[model samples]
Target: MAENHEHGKMDITEQEKTFEGFVKASIWVAGVAIGILVFLAIFNS
Candidate 1:
């Protein structure tokens, strides 16, 4: 029915937003981890 189609669209939109947020967070974490490793190498050397 039309109602089910509308609900499915809403669910898809919500999932997309959640996935985008997760990707952004993962990138930030990776950047921070790399920064820390570089700093450690510099300090140890």
Candidate 2:
């Protein structure tokens, strides 16, 4: 098999954007989950 190995020649803008979006979404989800847990703990006592 012929191998074409080029370093830093590939377009990664889309991948970077997708990863940024994933990180943002993960942080938001975690914050919301923690907020819900705090609310439940405070009100359920």
Candidate 3:
């Protein structure tokens, strides 16, 4: 039973790390997309 609890905690920690990584990646992607859009607008205008 204790082993199972420990395993569960490990799983949760891994999941949290994965989620944080995804969030960071998404923010980077969004920033790049916004930068591209702004550049295009300036160039087109």
Candidate 4:
């Protein structure tokens, strides 16, 4: 039997690993989506 070893390398940064960063990102995405929707609604009519 062979023992498995971990690579121990992280693909993501430490700043993006925090809950605060996640919430901030979610809010930013939501705001952008809402702005797009509003623009489409106003221009489509």
Candidate 1 C-alpha error for residue 23, in Å: 0.2
By lDDT, who's the top model here?
A: 2
Model 1: which ten-residue window has the lowest total lDDT? 2-11
Against the true structure, candidate 2 has what lDDT?
0.95
Candidate 1 lDDT, tens digit per residue, 1-45?
Answer: 765565434547878899999999999999999999999999988
Displacement of the residue 14 alpha carbon in candidate 4, Å: 6.8
Error of 1 at 40 (Å): 0.2
TM-score of candidate 4 against the unseen true structure: 0.61
All candidates: CA RMSD (Å): 3.9, 1.4, 4.0, 5.8
Could you give candidate 4's per-residue lDDT for residues 1-45 as a string of tens digits? 224644655455675668778998999999999999999999999
**What are the runs in model 2 whose C-alpha is more than 4 Å off?**
none
Weakest ten-residue segment in model 3 by summed lDDT: 2-11
Candidate 4 off by > 4 Å: 1-17
lDDT of 2 by residue, 1-45 (tens): 237858788899999999999999999999999999999999998
> Can you tell me which runs of candidate 3 are displaced by over 4 Å?
1-11
Error of 2 at 38 (Å): 0.3
Tens digit per residue, CA lDDT, model 3, 1-45: 655565434547878899999999999999999999999999987
The alpha-carbon root-mean-square deviation between model 2 and the true structure, to one decimal in Å, is: 1.4
Model 1 residue 22 CA deviation (Å) reads 0.3
User: Would you list the clashing residue pairs of candidate 4?
Assistant: none
